[model samples]
Target chain A: MTTLLTDPATTGAHRADTTHPSVSPADAVRQTMTMAWRATLKMRRNGEQFFDVTIQPILFTAMFAFIFGGAIAGDVGSYLPLMIPGILAQTTLTACMATGVQLREDMDKGVFDRFKSLPIARIAPLAGPMVADLLRYGIAATLTFLMGLLMGYRPGGGVLGVIAGAVLAMIAGWSLAWVFAWVGTIGRSAQGVQGISMMIMFPLTFLSNAFVPVETLPGWLAAFVQVNPVSHVVSAIRDLANTGTLTAEVGWALAACAIVVAIFAPLSVAAFRRRM
Target chain B: MYAVTTSPTPPTTSAVRTEGLVKAFGGRRAVDGIDLEVFPGEIFGVLGPNGAGKTTVLRMLATLLAIDEGRAEIFGVDVRERPHVVRQLIGLTGQYASVDENLTATENLVLFGRLQGLRRADARGTAARLLDRFGLGDAASRPISQFSGGMRRRLDLAASLITRPPLIFLDEPTTGLDPRTRGQMWDTIRELVDDGATVLLTTQYLDEADQLADRIAVIDAGRKVAEGTPDELKSSVGDSSLHLLLADPTQLAAAAETVRRQLGGEPVLTPERGRITVPLERADRAADVLTALRTAGISLSSMSVQKPSLDEVFLALTGHDTHSETQETAA
Candidate 1:
């Protein structure tokens, strides 16, 4: 306490107006990767965070296929192609939803306060967990396909188609996670984010051609199913995984994913900045 | 001027300067119209009760919270204008331990370094040195959730020092520690100043400010009541006083008489019939009062020797206690 006045090094140590610059684009990317590394570390410590991507994928795939196959398609074998891709889309959405809920929980922790006090890019903390979440989406997509294979369902698209379908679905899932991330930023609590996510997700997944085809619905219902981004994605997955065709549906799915990212990415960043 | 890439130029004599700083939550201003100036290389203390807005002031200066309706500058750079540059100049240890609970102590420190642009190997080296310095070497690999409160606080402080900015903000840095750990924390804070970092700390304990601060600002209800050396603040309030409770309410007058005989000033009576507060010139005078009360046939229930409470200090300095209904503004 006494030495502070005598010591010039400790007190008034500011030098020539350095005015260190804010983070650059390159530094923003680097900082995001570091935040991603932190998310992976958190995942390792709390393995339960993976439950939705793992157990839910297998459970929903098997339960939906066995129960709806015979009645909707006239035979379980015939239902495989349609059901598998739909399950893939559904499970991926579930995985993406967890991204927002977990983000809400993570933000409430004391460490996030420290992150705010640092000079890192504002979007790093929000996007880092989404980047690490690519694995969760991958797991959910693969398990849905594997479970289909074990149930004696074969895709005409074969190995290339399945891999391509999985990759496309994962990309869609990652982009769509921005919606949940935005919710996480705006929602008051983790449970609140989950509730709003479920409200949004259940309708998108259920009202689409995920479990049932579009033709079976009323005219107005079918029209909505035609435009619901989830249907485009499912149709795209079906083309890639069931027929090995990269058709217009695939393009539509990619365009939808791009638009979601373009809109919701900025929304998430803006809300996150306000929180800090 | 914004493009000039120098170190914000050595702050103009003041390490920290804030004018009319305010932070509002909805309708209430947590910190309202407060001004502060802290010289470089000094340990300046903000002394106040729990709601005195000490942390709010620190957070605004540290750039952790927005400064509403006022100007805050670190060195000479305006906080509102260049928060990033201000962040580069200051380190803040929040009241709660802000280290990651999911990470090991070493990993937490390294992660903080990496976030600040340190290379991996350099971060690891710094982590090892800090872990050893804070006496957490043995538990460096242990998860933070397993650490004791004192250990967690130490690790939190270590994380803040990883970059070692020239100015530090410590918000109630030792609120809940055993006496021994508290003493060690005070020593560590002194060491930081000796190494040449200007520190602005907020504390509820007057003794902590007396021990660590070169100057003190007494705050209450988001306002600075007094600013001076510790001796000046203590002198205005007399000194640390004595609080004694009698075993029998009937003995209160006799104990009061004994206190008056042993110490010159009239003892203050409390609402409680058996308790009285005796201000002291020196702490040793407490022993004289205690001995006189016992010899005067006054039985004691409990006794404490301490600095005037926030209430006591407020009464002495502003002629009013802190409770809202008891407030006598005109007086």
Candidate 2:
């Protein structure tokens, strides 16, 4: 055989002696960040992707706060503390659903076929976009708070507490996105992924205490709401944003987020590997 | 340019070698028990009609799909057991342009370069150099959405070459190109082999295989039917064949008889359409067959003589037409 390229960057054949040295955990993380950069570029080019994150949060925060303000709580000002955090959690989680839809859409493209053929980590394709999707959650969380501030709702817990709440919600959204990313890998088509993601997302968001108090529901339903992971996230956000303090609920929400990621991360990776 | 003695890996006899490689989708074997041996620095062509599982074979070897049975090795490395090593040893450009559509051409290349383990700065440098080499310098920063099909293909190929793997898999590299672009792609592929890269390309175009491949394997229904040099294959199918569309399909049987009796050759017949393709030893011999058919009152609607199509090659090698098999698969 003829000698291959002399350039060090192109000496792929020369490195063949290193048998089965799969990409290290560190390399996988680096590759995943590179993929996230790609996803960010896609998000920048497709501005329509931000419609849900930007507009939905603003609209939901205003509409839900005013419409249910009197019925759920005493008045609009009192409801602001409870409803604003609820809106933050709701918008962030909804934005998380887009992660799966976009993943499905991206995977449907021919570029993904090339990604699959590359020598990169299998998790790179699935996790990269989810990592970048933290931005969508960030935007949603911020917009919800901004909208709340505009509507005469003040955070008693101050700037630090508000930031913490937003950060927690962003983390929760990123973690839950693993569930949808899993759906993206297993779903038959992009539309199918969106449909399944919504079916899962809507129930998780609406059945929780995002817009209404869980105690008002029947005893059995209240028990389910207490266990609902989204309720914990919303409660945790409220505790931080209104009281400016960490509570057991915040710890519970963080643990729940970690559990979701731990369970679904492997599932998403395995599904992505088996997609073809 | 010939300063070549610092090789790290042992020299192998073949660039790509596979034995009884099988891939089944559900219950149907898309690539069943196929064997291939492609030497280094040669353009090995996988020629088949649509749905012949040519892409499936490429995907399996590229580690995009799992092999259902049998063994495949790239440059002496097992494909299934160690895909990471095999991936490092080869470059795969799929049937469609595989470059990211959302990014500009330069960004896409740099992305792949970084994915190839190049640092950020080196990835940028390599992207610029590859763009210049592929004649895509002018469109380097344009988003891939603005690219022509041929340009996207070039960029896709450039992405694969970032690591300069010894073996390259190109699945129908010029299937949808204009003739001018197809010629350009053919020149590019030839350039790869000259630079010590082995290429395995698949196509449904017999003319493409003739012009490019050092050796050709003709497959049908997931099984390889014939493998030989282009000259050996052409000798069986002939240089050109007369395609006659009969006025009345019912008289096809009679027309086949007249051609056989006059030319002493077998004809490929489509009974439903009353079409007959008769291989010719020379173009001048078309007169004899036409004269014989007219005398037998087997009037023709239209006729032309041209190079043998893949269908003709299939008929000559498999003794059955490819049109029926492709229709059955409906790909």
Candidate 3:
């Protein structure tokens, strides 16, 4: 076989104006957004799986509210505002695991290997998947709240308070996604990621006061529950929904969210940088 | 600019060059001290076996993996210093189809073009042009999962070429395809080279390397054993082979040992089949070998002399057959 070598002089003259084509930070951000959007679009094509987020949240929220509202509190009204926020927080965070699982799937299927070879942003694949996952969490959180409202769980918090509760939950979901992304990057397979993520999340969600008050627990358990980040977030949401109050606890919960993002965002990017 | 010619003149602006690249995983070296110079519009083949570190070399060249030692340059830009610049001038298609199976072929191509910074309309145009070029126009709307292996491979290749990158890395581009599809892919690759695009190809198929490579580099166990044109490497080990098949199944081992003792090299035993093969440098060596066999009373079922293949050259240099190992791993 004969391969014709192009005239370097011609290419040099043509590329002189181009100089060095480098991926600027702004371009990296744009590429990340584009990659994330593409990933979400692919997920939407199936359309069947979207119901997992939209319908699961609504069904789980309403079922948990009705089932627990009577047995635990003996009255539905007494727990509507309290339980809705807890359910919303719990449901959204659980949905965040899908982000890591999907990433593991992509890696196993060699999608990231392809991206590594392309002239795109270094963090596009990692950042893009995280960004796209926000949409899933957002949809799940919104549907849960709407179902709560339809079932007569009027948030004592006004629209602003309701938005604040949702915003906190959204940020919590997004921040938590970074941790899962890191796990997914290092985990061997999607099944391994699922097992590890579930193990990590089960303790966090169940140990926190998602279903009951922390004071009712044993002294040692209460100490663990109080320090748990999920408890802070749940308490913050409960405060917003039940009394529409932005207490010091809520401020602390926001700090915790920032802290998780601070730690895991860079870690996820660094881990993802080597995944290819 | 499009119709280039093969010339010995070194390009003043090389598309990509490597100097003593080295990479290792968990203390096992994959690419060790390989030097390559890829000029614009040339298809340079890195021909090696399954674990010869071809993919590692390609990955490092594409800036996917970091260099452990030495330097790599892409379009005059230092790869270690400005990886983004190196990435901009290159495209890569891995051994497997890397398309998102959930998306349609058209969607996959358009998305890739968009990632390359093409405008929405231009991305779509590029997608359409590529689909048409690869005979995937009609199936553009179908999800990639629904396509056959050949169709998926075509889409995969098309997606890589979306930006018309000046340099491309195609790692085992035609593995697992039927002969007809493989030929189609060859034509497509030739078209790219003809259009003044430089390509660096890596393959285990000797024919693939011979059919496409302007210069071939044969690697063994993370090191380059020999590097030259196909003819040069084949002729280096001579052009003939002498194969002996023992009539008595029990005598096969003795014959092989006898051949090894006479030839001063270990003869290859085709597993489970009763045959021993050795490289022949001259035709008269066959007569000498036959005389020795008669004196030793080694009976043969069949004996023949034929031209040496690239496989023989590979075995002569590496002491292992590439096909048998890959078949074992695949099984």
Residue A249, candidate 3: Cα error in Å is 4.4
DockQ, prediction 1: 0.34
Q: Kindly list the per-residue Cα lDDT of model 2 for residues B1-331, writing each as its tens digit.
A: 1122434666555678899999887788889899999987789999998888899999989988888899998877788888887877788898888889889999999898877678888889888999999999999999999999999999999998887777899999998999999999999999988877889999989999999999999988899988999988988776787889999899998999988987888999999988999877888899988899889888899999997778888888888877766532312
| Cα-based lDDT at residue A80, candidate 3 | 74
Flag clash pairs in model 2: none
Q: On a 0 to 1 DockQ scale, where is model 3?
A: 0.21
Ranking by TM-score: 1, 2, 3
| Collision pairs in model 1 | A10-B196, A11-B41, A16-B7, A17-B6, A17-B7, A17-B8, A17-B9, A18-B6, A18-B7, A18-B8
Q: Relative to the unseen true structure, what is the C-alpha lDDT of residue B323 in candidate 3, on a scale of 0 to 100?
A: 70
Better of 1 and 3 by DockQ: 1
- CA shift of B294, model 1, Å: 15
lDDT value for model 1? 0.84
Fnat of all models, as shown? 0.50, 0.42, 0.33
Deviating ranges (above 4 Å) for candidate 2: A1-15, A18-20, B1-10, B239-306, B327-331
RMSD of each: 5.2, 6.1, 7.8
Q: Model 1 chain B — which ten-residue stretch has the worst lDDT?
A: B322-331
List residue ranges in candidate 1 displaced over 4 A.
A1-16, B1-4, B7-13, B241-306, B320-331
- What order do candidates take by lDDT, descending? 2, 1, 3
